[model samples]
Target chain A: MHKKHNFGAGPCILPSSVMEQAAQAVINWGGMGLSILEVSHRSPEFEDVVLKTQLLVRELLSVPDHYSVLFLQGGASTQFAMVPMNFLSAGKKAAYLDTGYFAQKAIKEAKLFGEVELVASSKDKDYAYIPVGFNNDKHAAYLHCTSNNTIEGTEIFDFSTAGAPLICDMSSDIFSRKINITDFDLIYAGAQKNMGPAGMTLVIAKNEFLDQAKKEIPSMLDYRVFRDNMSMYNTPPVFSIYVAMLNLLWLKDQGGVSGIEQRNIEKAKLLYAEIDRNPLFYGTADVEHRSRMNVTFLAINKEVETGFLKFAADMGIVGIKGYRTVGGFRASLYNALPLSSVEVLVNAMASFEKIYSDKTVLELE
Target chain B: MHKKHNFGAGPCILPSSVMEQAAQAVINWGGMGLSILEVSHRSPEFEDVVLKTQLLVRELLSVPDHYSVLFLQGGASTQFAMVPMNFLSAGKKAAYLDTGYFAQKAIKEAKLFGEVELVASSKDKDYAYIPVGFNNDKHAAYLHCTSNNTIEGTEIFDFSTAGAPLICDMSSDIFSRKINITDFDLIYAGAQKNMGPAGMTLVIAKNEFLDQAKKEIPSMLDYRVFRDNMSMYNTPPVFSIYVAMLNLLWLKDQGGVSGIEQRNIEKAKLLYAEIDRNPLFYGTADVEHRSRMNVTFLAINKEVETGFLKFAADMGIVGIKGYRTVGGFRASLYNALPLSSVEVLVNAMASFEKIYSDKTVLELE
Candidate 1:
């Protein structure tokens, strides 16, 4: 069977090799004669999986020893609540950037715990670009921002925290790029996009920062509990973590995050150039703030939009439909999405443009 | 490779058939040329998966129309906090039966939300039996109970609610038996044991009871939000739910819950009988309260105990080690554990007993 070009936004693509190995492990992990699904989390085999996965995250990111890396459930949505539940003590305020859909969500959950100051917002421009130079409260409990907006196809390349401790939801773009781990106190990502799959969230937080989190909160929500217990305070999403370990191993083989980031940049640049040069389509999001992961674009009209989607589907191009809130096409160039797939999508675009342009000229004559 | 008997307490065995299908889907789901891990949770294909999974649970359990079946993340440990965060209101006491380790953890989370009335406990006997006939507060907001203690090797065969709204954590014994859906206001289980795998939690709650839950809780912890959104509040654990659907289909093929309950009983009976008849072994939990899912037993002495464990390991019988708090052996008979596996365990026990007893005779002589 021909490989379909997958461009799903969050539960996006993964290396075929990772998928093959993951599938095999589900049947017989490490030749144990027992499926990974059936293995006890406490067993030495699974404990090693957890340990190696943590080591990979740390080694790949150059994470400091002071930071605790955790594989927890409930995705980034749970972290929205947990962030404030842990750090935002009663009567204290937390500063937030209103970047896009997820940023707004993080702010909403924080309000349930304490005060939230919206230090900056791009909602005024339909979240088309990232905001800059906004005044932030250094004295606030901590500053929170979504480093990448999966829905709006915007990413923050430049971060300025204004002296406050930084917490970022990097769900859509984590592991696709390299960043200074010391720049933020906490960094979290749901492992669906560039890491592995859904069902697990990766958290890296400074131990001192974790110690400042509120006491008496639910143990499951406590960052310190996971940190202290090596993220095994409870039964983890075992298979998800294992697959993530495989995917990360693949990343390490490709020369780690820095290597993958170059490929990601090339794929994004190739697609964005086609979107700009093609007369039949236009790119969404400001060029400066556009995401290297999710490339949102639009056809000149609805007729062409619907036709192009069907046209792409016929070529085994799937999961390119844009999120409902942002109507149009979103070709996600996640880490696992090959440059070859991007070329196929770009070629499809150029061919459709030629056909449509010729048809329009003939009608005018 | 020889098949190993998997009897790990939780994250236990699944049918080999289910594992095969789950593995295939990970490589190429439904001939889509995309791994299930790479598919969008919002895609129609996966939407159908979530819907069918819910339908299967409803159909298999004969769940009433008033109950909403939801698939959520964070396992049962998260449910411990969510249960009280949603139900236990300020100034209202919630009654709890302290059955074992998990039960105590649930009680701890509940105390963070409101007053917790310890309705009953078997701690006096090291959790060797299920407590019975203890006075309960009917005026409490809700009554919480763990139906099966995975670590204690005790199961509650009967339940009395004392007129309070009933909530049960059936993490270890949910699909192992058939129960009246109307007996409780809410029922929850982590999918690892009898359903599918870890990472997903199955929640079936009466809609009316959900309405009484506290407002202003975090959306992830709010049962009503999940009920309203069809459990897609935020990209539900896609792969876990898909595998669970496959496993549930396997259960349906095996004549559903009641059918599996009989086989589970037979497997439990076979192992427990051997534990009783063997001169070198004795069952740990009270005879009447012994768990059909996990049969906990002790050996005649430390030497024989160490010897039997090694003896069983050589035969590829695995995951039968008992909890440290109650050590000897714990042969968990979850639904997926075939009677053949149980026979091997029983035979091992009898063989070990014969060898040890003969040694004892020779030593005495």
Candidate 2:
């Protein structure tokens, strides 16, 4: 069967070899004659998988030695609440930049713990662009931002590299690019995007950020519980973490983050250029703030949008439907999306333009 | 290669077919030519999986329509905090029955939200037995208990199910029994036990209980979010839930809860009977409060325990080691544990008995 070019926002595409190796471990892990799922997280073998996965993340992003990496559940969504619960103490307020649907969710969650001031917002323009030069409080504990707006295809071009300890929800574009880890106080991402599978949420936090937690919070939700135990607070998502470890190893083998980032830049450029050059389609995300990880565009002729969709569907471009909130097309270009897949999407776009342009001209005359 | 039994507490054993189906879906899901992991949770097909998984859960447990089934992450460990975060309001004391490690964790989390009263406890006896006569408080919001203690090898004979809106953490023995689902207001279990794999927690709650959630809780932790969205508020653990649904369907094919309950009872009886009949082994956990799912036993000859473990290991009886907190041998007979596996454990015990008896006589002289 031909592989489809998957553009899912999350619970997204993973390397084929990672899936195969993961499946093999499901039946019998290593030579232990037991499934990896059956092994104890406390066991040395399972511990190594967790350690190596964290190490790979550290190495990929060049994470500082003072920071800790954690594998959590509930994805980036869970962190929406946990961030406030841990840090939003003393009736103090936190600043958040509103970009897309997830930003709205984070804002809502933070409101429960303490005050959340919307520092900047692109809601007026339907989150079609990333808001910059945010109004933030100097007294605020931290400034939160989503590195990549998954729904809106907007990306932050420049951020406060050293201000109020930046906390980023990098769920969409963590290891896909080379990041200056020291710039952010804490960063979290679900493994489904650019990493490996669902079930594990990767959290990287500075040691000092751990001091923000109040004593009243639950231990499991506390960063200290995970940090102290070394992400072994509970039996982790073993199989997911193991596969993520394999994916990280795979990523490392492919020239680390720098190499992949360059490839991602080129892939997104190829696909976005096809949308820009074609009269049949127009890109949605602001050209200046376009995400390098996701290419979002709308069909130029609304009446023929269904026809374009059908054409793309026939060509095996799956999960290209933009979020309902921002209807059109969105091709997520995560780390696992190879250059070949991007080429395929570009070719599909060209083929659609050739088919639709002739029909549109006849109607206009 | 033979498949060995996996018994590492949570993230434990799973249905063999679930893994096979999950692996297949990674390549192509329902002819979509995309990995199941690559589909958006917002999509209709993924939503179908979510709804169907919930529907089947209701059917399997004979759960009433008033009850809502929620799939969340962080397992029972997170629920420990989430329950209190949601339901603990009005300064009313919630009854916490400290049965074992998980129960104590819940108690610790509850203290953060509101006043929690330790209504009953088994801690005095090192959590080896379920306590008796938990006073049902008319003023109490809920009475929480751990139905089966995975570590302590104890289970409540009858869940204090009828009074004070009973809530139970059935993590270790959820599907291993047939119970009146209506008797409890809430029942939760992590999928690792007998359901499927780890990284997913099954929460079944009365709709009214969800309505009682305090507005102070975070939106992501709100039961209302899951209740309204049918557990698809965010991208779910696609692979984990798919595996869980597959296992649920497989259980239905195996004659549902009633069928599995009978098998669990038989499996537990087989192991416990061998322990009682043989003088070399002594059972942990009180006889009256003995768990039907996990049977923990210690060697009567103190020096021969290691030898017994080695003998059992050599004979291919996996996961026989008891929890380190309560040291001994624990044979967990969860829903996925085949009766044949119990037979293997018993056979290993029978052989070990002969060897220990001969060695003890020589040492006594």
Tens-digit per-residue lDDT, B273-342, candidate 2:
9999988788988999899887888887656678888887777777778788777788877777778888
Model 2 / residue A20 / CA error / Å: 1.3
The sequence of per-residue lDDT tens digits that candidate 1 reaches over residues A1-365 is 89899988979889999999999998999899999999999999999999999999999999999898998998899999999999998878999999999999999999999999999899999898999997777788999999989889899998755667999999999999998889899999999998888999999999889989898989999988898898999999999999999999999999999999999999999999999999889988999999999899988899899989999999999988888988999988998888999999999999998888888899999
For each candidate, report what fraction of the true interface contacts it reproduces. Answer: 0.82, 0.66
The reply for model 2, stretches above 4 Å from the true place, is A361-365, B160-162, B362-365
lDDT per prediction? 0.91, 0.82
How do all models score by TM-score?
0.99, 0.97
Q: Candidate 1, residues B1-365: lDDT per residue as tens digits? A: 99898888889899999899999999999898889989999889999999999999999999999999999998899999999999998889999999999999999999998899998899999999988887767788889999999988999998755578899999999988899889999999999999998989999999999999998999999999999999999988898899899989999998999999999888888888888888888998998998999889888899988999999999899988899878888889998988998888888888887888888899999
At residue B361, what lDDT does model 1 achieve? 93
Q: Put down candidate 2 lDDT per residue, A40-141, tens digits, no spaces.
A: 677788888888988998898898899998888888888998898888777678889899888888888888778888888999998989887666676787
| Per-model DockQ against the true two-chain complex | 0.87, 0.65
Judged by lDDT against the true structure, how good is candidate 2?
A: 0.82
Q: Which candidate should be chosen as best, given TM-score against the real structure?
A: 1
